[model samples]
Target: MAHIMITGGSSGIGLQIARLLVQRGERVSLLARDPAKLEAAKHALQSQYPDSRPVHIQAVDVTDGAALHAAVMDCVASQGAIDTLIASAGMIVPGSFLDQTAGDFNSQIDTNLIGVANAIRAVYPSMIAAGRGTITIISSGAALLGIPGYTAYCASKYGLRGLATALRLEAKPKGVSVCICFPPDTDTPQFRQEIAQRGPETKRFLGPPKPWPVETVAKHIVKGMDAGKGEIFFGFDMMMLDKLGPIIRPILEKAYERRNKKHIGAQEGR
Candidate 1:
């Protein structure tokens, strides 16, 4: 049986991935903060697989390095080394440049960027020792296309993309594959909450409609992880943006200006 460790497996895309992996008979270990939610997710998985491989939960914040390392070590020891590690823990707190605080940006960088780094640091040595493993980092469409009001979210996700690129180069000789995923607007609670935060004018600034069910994105990610892909940009407009990166930037910038104009008008009316 393949042993897999997934951070943020308690909910959303991570939870979906965990459920699918467990259904496929993989030994799944969850690293998440909420014990109750984690237990609930585990129960849901167990309901589907009564004879499923072990589903262990390590309830701890991904931002906590020492604790994260301990949790990884414990999982690795128990599972006889993880065959795969998915750094899927992430969040979004959207705001325009003027409305956001230093804390807002820092918190995202700490969780979205440093969180991935910490998990990789904790998992890589064991994977290297085993001489085989795959690491999947969950980025976002914002990493490729800049959204009008989501400066911090885009920056942190871009950092994840960069980290994945570098790690790919580093792990090549060790037979370890690193995969970076760029998923579009997922129908997760976080996306719904961010859209709800939008003012009338800025709501349009969210850019394009959300598409693809959460399960579809999760399946695509699993396929990429299994194939040892360097990076997988999933979803509709996101793939186009990545393909058109050279010409897409200037076009997106102009579009964002128009979107900002609407926001400015809304603010003036207020």
Candidate 2:
């Protein structure tokens, strides 16, 4: 059984991934900021896998590099050096660029981008010396293009793509592998919160297909990790965008232009 460490493992995709790994008899540890949530996740896992060892957990925010490193070491001492690291903790706030706060923008970068770096930095040396490991960064579809109300979120996730790209090159020769997943909107607490925060403008820009269930998203991510894929993308649309993002952006922009003009005409009763 491999020892897997997941940040943000108390809930959403992180927790679901842990469930899958545990079901397969892997040793798992969790890191998240909320003690109550972490404790609850631990109990839930233990209840499900009654025969397995207790999952180690730490209540620490990933944005704090030093604290996160210490938490990782604590898990390492308890379970073993983490053979797999999934950096899945992230947040998004939807609003027009002018309405987004400077603090919120900086927070997204720190938590999503720098936080990922910290998790990677904590485990990278050990993985390199051990000569084997996997690191999975959970980016988003927003990373590939500009979203109407996700300026900061897009920037942070895009940073993750770049982080994984460079790290993949450095890790391959050392027998460590890096994978980045671009999951489209997934139904989770975070997504619900995002929906609540979205303004009419934001909602107008987004419609149709609902978010994928968190279970499905987690399953795909785990399967990708199991297969050692360097990049994991769910859904045909996402795969298409990954292949044709640059080419497709212009088309989407024109559509957005037409949609905006129509909205303006309606507002003016023209």
Q: Which candidate is the best by lDDT?
A: 2
Per-model clash counts, in order, read 0, 0
Best by TM-score, which number? 2
Query: RMSD of each candidate?
Result: 2.1, 1.1
Query: What is the lDDT for 204 in model 1?
Result: 68
Local accuracy of candidate 2 as per-residue lDDT tens digits, 190-219 = 888888887766566666538999999999
**Candidate 2 structure lDDT:** 0.91
Per-residue accuracy of model 1 over 55-116 as CA lDDT, tens digit each = 89889888899999999988877776888889999978778878889998788888899998
Off by over 4 Å in 1: 199-202, 259-270
The TM-score between candidate 2 and the true structure equals: 0.98
Root mean square deviation (Cα) for candidate 1: 2.1
* Local distance difference test scores for all models: 0.85, 0.91
